[model samples]
Target: MTGTPEQVPAAEFGPPEDDIARLWTPHRMVYIGGQDKPADDTPAQCPFCRIPAGDDESGLVVARGRACYALLNLYPYNGGHLMVLPYRHVSDYPDLTDAETSELAAMTQTAMRVLRAVYAPAGFNLGMNQGEAAGAGIAAHLHQHVVPRWTGDANFLPVVGRTKALPELLADTRARLAAAWPDA
Candidate 1:
């Protein structure tokens, strides 16, 4: 294995295949490459800020609050995975205004309720990734993740294959959640 690029055989680049089945998810390459990630922390570069500018269905917005909103995650961890974010561009949780904080928490609760009504998940994971060091994909704008979980949701696919198998489309999931969202 200690040879120059030209001298090394092509066989050495990749290991031989095993008996495991392959799940080709080439579409995930774009997200893995950060193709749509914002280059800067400005509001103009923030997807959360831009999403509200369009209509609800097109943006996958499930519900809208006065100071915050709920929308489906473009790259969801599960079928009903969604996010709650404040309208105003803010990075840190402490930076949120009182109204934004209130609405954000309220929307988060509503998201869980709606998911229960729509998907009837066995459990849920709710949290916010504070910064890049904490595993935040887009740390510039703070958003709380609301992930619904079933008993066997985390199967070998995500663990061994490093991919998730979502059973439903985002658009369809969005419509269901939007419809199930209680009137404000």
Candidate 2:
């Protein structure tokens, strides 16, 4: 007798399968739902501003400079994706003081080096989304993205499924990068 769709046995559908592994990322729903996103564009509610105030490990901070800091992206495009931003609640890159600008640039370079030392990615993509119109999720704070890429990293998943398959956890990746950070 035939069963309902829910009651259908997997073994009856096709040949024996063992190589495929599924990554169930239900946690991404929180990001999609915009849970921790600040209610308004203010330093008081900004996540970027609050991150540096807490402990580095808990904050997933890979490194901290005088004016800027680096932390893992809570919603990452790749395994070791990170962002470099100033501690001050400045929204525009041009508004950054000379010291903050210098430190941010230097830290971005360091983040690239540290990612190489840890993940040895094949390439990198770096940029900053300036405002809400430009696709900045948090237009209230300025932050630069540093994403590590590998050969054959792109696949049907992100294109067809709109989801990325990351092999490492953010906390573990943070620990590895922090440990490998220069002068850390």
Candidate 3:
């Protein structure tokens, strides 16, 4: 949406995943596009902490724990998606302690349960990016993504426009997930 300062979105956002959708909000634009490389080499502040704190309910969250926790992906690949992160905050997987590793695995099991209950997606994609070249958006903090997918869900939207078409809004998905969290 092209507009002057008064016409800007009230909420913060980021750049489009591709070209078709221009991420209009300021929040998304940062720390997204290929993981910005800093001259100072300092890691940026945690984005999940920042966004969740802003609205008090953006579906972006980190369920705290001694070792690891589950968190919703603010920019999700699919609805009812989330991630497994260790509290230790290491970017590489080898650095994870046995307890943290166990917690990550356990929380991931919970994540699958949570997504299944909430979205009932036909399938799932679970993966991790070890480093910058491998597509790790946050190269310093190693985490696993849990994306729920359906049959024929991949379409021209992302390929043609470089935009993703989500059937439901984040708020609605959050409500469903919040209601389902008790089951986890």
Instruction: Provide TM-scores for the models.
Output: 0.90, 0.87, 0.71
TM-score of 3: 0.71
Q: Output the lDDT of residue 81, model 1.
A: 97
112: Cα error in model 2, Å:
0.6
Candidate 1: residue pairs that collide: none
What is the alpha-carbon lDDT of model 2 when measured against the actual structure? 0.91
Kindly indicate the candidate among 1 and 3 with the higher lDDT. 1
Candidate 1 C-alpha error for residue 138, in Å = 0.9
What does candidate 1's lDDT look like per residue over 9-106, in tens digits?
88887745788777777888989999999999999999999999999988999999899999999989989999999999899999999999999999
Which lDDT value does model 2 have at 47?
A: 92
lDDT score for residue 143 of model 1: 96
* Model 2 per-residue lDDT tens digits across residues 96-129: 9999999999999999998998889999999999
- Number of colliding residue pairs in each model: 0, 0, 7
Task: Provide the lDDT at 43 for model 1.
Answer: 98
- Candidate 3 collision pairs: 13-25, 13-28, 14-28, 14-29, 20-161, 91-140, 91-141
Residues 87-130, candidate 3, lDDT per residue (tens digit)?
Answer: 55577788899999988888887778878877788989999989
Please give the CA lDDT of all the candidate structures.
0.92, 0.91, 0.69
RMSD of every candidate to native, in Å, equals: 2.7, 4.2, 7.8
